[model samples]
Target: MVRRIETDRLILRTVTVDDAEDIFKWASDPDVNKFMIYPLHKDIEVTKEWLRSRDIDGNDEFDLGFVLKETGELIGQGGIFYKEDLDAWAIGYNLRKEYWGQGLVPEAMKAIIDYVDKEKGIHAIVGEFAKDNSKSRRVMEKLGMTYWKDCQYSKFDGSATFDAYLYKREF
Candidate 1:
């Protein structure tokens, strides 16, 4: 089972079926989805279906939602994607527009990184962000991730693509 992690002001926990509405609220926002790998979800059913497809009980990596501990409000989602061949994991996260600039993402990410390094025996954690997203790049740097490569990443809209910076941090 996925474990719950607590920081001073946030809680990181597994996504649940009941979280469909909360997921839809932020994920459907075009601004939030602009730099994300996937397109903005069109409806609640789409969000529900996506959540249903996730495997929380298997060895597959998990995605978690970031919640405000005080109010139990969902603010963002992020987690590690296990890469067997690399013997590492890739980290990713997205926050609600209203929560931007609050330093919550970094806090949540740091906590998760600590968990992965200490409990999961991961050798390193990797991440890639659209080059245009300077905020995200800053978060990676804050987590002590160093720039390692550059490559093109396909956007949700098949009509175009953009450059991305790959980052990595070894344990």
Candidate 2:
């Protein structure tokens, strides 16, 4: 089962269909989508459909909703998944523009990384971000993840391509 994680100010729980609206808030924002692999969600149905397709059962991977503890609002999403091709567990996250520069992503990410290391005994965690996303890169750096390499990135729908910098933390 997917475990619910709690930080001092946030709750990281499995995504639900009910979270579509909040998800769309950021998923549709141009600033948030500027570096993401998926296009901006044009409708709530799109977010709902995407949530339905995610395998958040805890057996495979986790795509969690990051909720604010004080307001009980989902501020973002974060997850780690095993990549067969790279033979490593890859991590990612997205947050609403208003929450940017708050150090929330790193807090949530650190919780996930710790959980995975303890429960899964997996140490190879990788991350990648658009080269232009310095904020994201800073998160990786804060995690002490080392720069791996740069690779080509394509949107899920094949609508765009960009250079992506990869980082990895191996225990």
Candidate 3:
């Protein structure tokens, strides 16, 4: 079963079919999808379909939605994409524009890193950010992730390549 993680300000939990409306609200915003690997969700049905296929029990890596503890508001989504070759996990997160400057992403990230470290016996966690996304890069730095390398990676749209900075932190 997928577990729930609580941070000071947010709750990290598995996405459910009931979360479709919330997912659509934030995911359909073009601004939120700007740096994401996938485009803004087109409609509620699309979001529901995506949620239906996210089998957290079977997948080694799966996505989870972030919610505000006090308000019960869905803020965003994040997950660890396990990398077997490196024996590490690649972390990714996206926050709604309204919550951008509140320092919630790092709060959520800390809970995830801590959980994976103890439960999964993770040695390290890594992440990549588009070179131009200064905010995200700062979050990596805030989480103590060191700059490890740089490379060009394919964009979500599959139309072109973009420069990205790789960051990592050992447990």
Candidate 4:
């Protein structure tokens, strides 16, 4: 099950196959998916199939849709998941390009972090970004995450790889 997290400007809630259309708006955008691990969705069915396979209950993954409170539009998707290697939760997000720089990333993520801290008593939270992704780096920094180490990440399909930085904040 997905958790519901509310912010002043957004509501993050369970993302289902019903959200494929709205999510595809950004999922299919090359610029938006450029740094993402998943392949560019060629059609809505791919998204629906993906959603059907998503494991939100187990794996300590609470994937959710970021919905605008004002108009109830799904703008993006992301959430926190357990990172076994770090023995901590790791954060991840992807937003519509139009929504970038509006500070929603930090707003939404802080809510998730706070929820995790309250519910799980997490000692530490982490966020990682490609070195070339300045916007993501800033989001981590704004969320009070400090650079922890140099890291590397790859696309889910292993089609591409990138040098990244791991950022962490301890509660």
Looking at model 1, the pairs that clash are none
28-113 in candidate 1: lDDT tens per residue?
99988888877779989988998898887755475779999989999899988788776679888989999998899889988887
Quote the lDDT for 129 in model 1. 88
Q: Find the 10 residues in a row with the least total lDDT in model 2.
A: 54-63
In angstroms, give how far residue 18 of model 2 lies from its true place.
0.9
Every candidate's lDDT? 0.85, 0.88, 0.83, 0.88
- Global local distance difference test of model 2: 0.88
Write down the worst ten-residue block by lDDT for model 4.
Answer: 55-64
Model 3 regions more than 4 Å off: none
Candidate 1 residue spans exceeding 4 A from truth: 156-160
lDDT of candidate 4 over 1-171, digit per residue (tens):
657989999998988888889988888899998888898988989888998898877647766788999999999887898888899899999899999999998899888778767877788889888899999999999988999999999989888899999999987
Model 1: lDDT to the true structure: 0.85
Comparing 3 and 4 on TM-score, the stronger one: 4
Instruction: Quote the RMSD, in angstroms, for model 4.
Output: 1.2
In Å, residue 36's CA in model 2 sits off its true spot by: 0.6
RMSD to the hidden true structure, all candidates: 1.6, 1.1, 1.6, 1.2
Q: Mind giving the per-residue lDDT tens digits that candidate 3 earns over 44-125?
A: 8988987888777844674678999999998798878688876779989988888998899888888887787776677788
TM-scores, all candidates, are 0.93, 0.96, 0.92, 0.95
